[model samples]
Target: MNVSNLCVLTVTVICMVLAWSEPSKACGSCTCSNGVVMSCPNIVQISLRSSGLTNLSGSAFQNNKIVTNIDLYGNQLVHLPAGLFKATTKLQTLNLRYNLLVDLPDGLFKATTELQTLDLDDNPLVHLPAELFNATTKLENLYLSRVQLDYLPAGLFDAITRIKVMYFWGNKFDHLHAGLFKATTELESLYFVRNQLVDLPDGLFKATTKLETLDLKENQLVHLPVGLFNATTKLRKL
Candidate 1:
């Protein structure tokens, strides 16, 4: 073969090798090397369930700009450093269930604007920052069950106007704000079971016109408001 043709062939072979190696290096593991997670451009999912992870560095996901799903369930993590997900701008699903987390840092998801589902179930979280989800405007499903929370700040869900399913079960909250679900007009299923609720405010579901299932079982509620469910025209369960 001529020198020019051989050079083109060599380049093609190198490109083919790189294309095959990127996914092979990142397909089944959370980190490609040295605890740095998802450094590959084609990798979109990272699963590190029950890996005994206690802590993560702030630059853990620094190279995962296009990662969409991350599952770190059943770990021993008590806290996450700030800006951990600063590079994961297209991240959509994040599952941190069954961890030892007590509280989350502020603005953790500030750069993760496209986040859709966030699962924080079975953690020891005692409080959540009001602006935690401010940048996650596309968030839809939120799982906060068994987090040991007693109160949620007002306007916490104000920016998540497209939220659909929310799980607030097994909490210590005795009451909820009347306008808690006002911005979640597209809310469909709401689970508030096993809480310390004594009463519900009027117009609680006024803006949640599309709410369908509302599970308030096992609470200390004494009576329902006169028109609490008036605006929840599609409510099928209570």
Candidate 2:
């Protein structure tokens, strides 16, 4: 071919390649459309709750992945990818309420260190990793309501002392590790409603001097432990 023709072809090829180099839409926040989900961009929050997405594996939510909140409510999904939110490190909140999550990977939320609020309500989790919230030291609110927990591991939340409000309602808990709340001396509100607990440990509230509210309604508890509220002398109304 002539030199001029070859140069023109090279330029055309370069332009074509550039035009076809759109970024891969690996994953992104999505919305449900007519009972089906559709991918959308620039979404900061995604509410896929109760949409019945049984298997959330073939997702490409890694593309424009600037999401901060993801809701998978009332689904049948039992597993989550370990690094699911590693690409969305800027995320601050996550709501996995009312699902079928049985367990989570140890470092599942390590990338979301900025996460301040987390909700795992109404799931079927029988056990949770003691270090589940170790990396989320900035967490202020945590919800584990309506799960099937029978006991909690000792010193589970030792690293997160900044929590203000926590909910442990509607579980099958019979006993709790007393040292679990050692780091929660700054706690203000706690809920143990509708549990099967028979008695609290001796020093249940020894370190919670700042506790203000305690809702133990509807539990199978027959009596509270000695000095359970001694440190919490600020208890105004129960």
> Model 1: per-residue lDDT, tens digit, 13-100?
3344345766454233332344454345665666766766777778677776787988888988999887889999999999999999
TM-scores, each model vs. reference:
0.86, 0.77
- Reference-based TM-score, model 1: 0.86
lDDT of 1: 0.83
Cα lDDT for residue 56, candidate 1: 79
In terms of lDDT, model 2 sits at 0.70
> Candidate 1: minimum summed lDDT over ten consecutive residues — where?
1-10
Supply candidate 1's per-residue lDDT for 16: 49
Question: Per the 3 Å backbone cut-off, how many clashing residue pairs does candidate 2 have?
Answer: 6
**Best candidate, lDDT:** 1
Candidate 2 lDDT for residue 196:
88
| Distance from true location, Cα of 177 in model 2, Å | 1.3
Compose the digit string of candidate 2's lDDT tens values, residues 26-122.
2323333332234444455555556554454323245325667766667676877776676666677888887888887777877777787899998
- The C-alpha RMSD of each candidate to the native structure, in angstroms, is 9.2, 11.7
Which residue runs of candidate 1 sit more than 4 Å off their true CA positions? 1-38
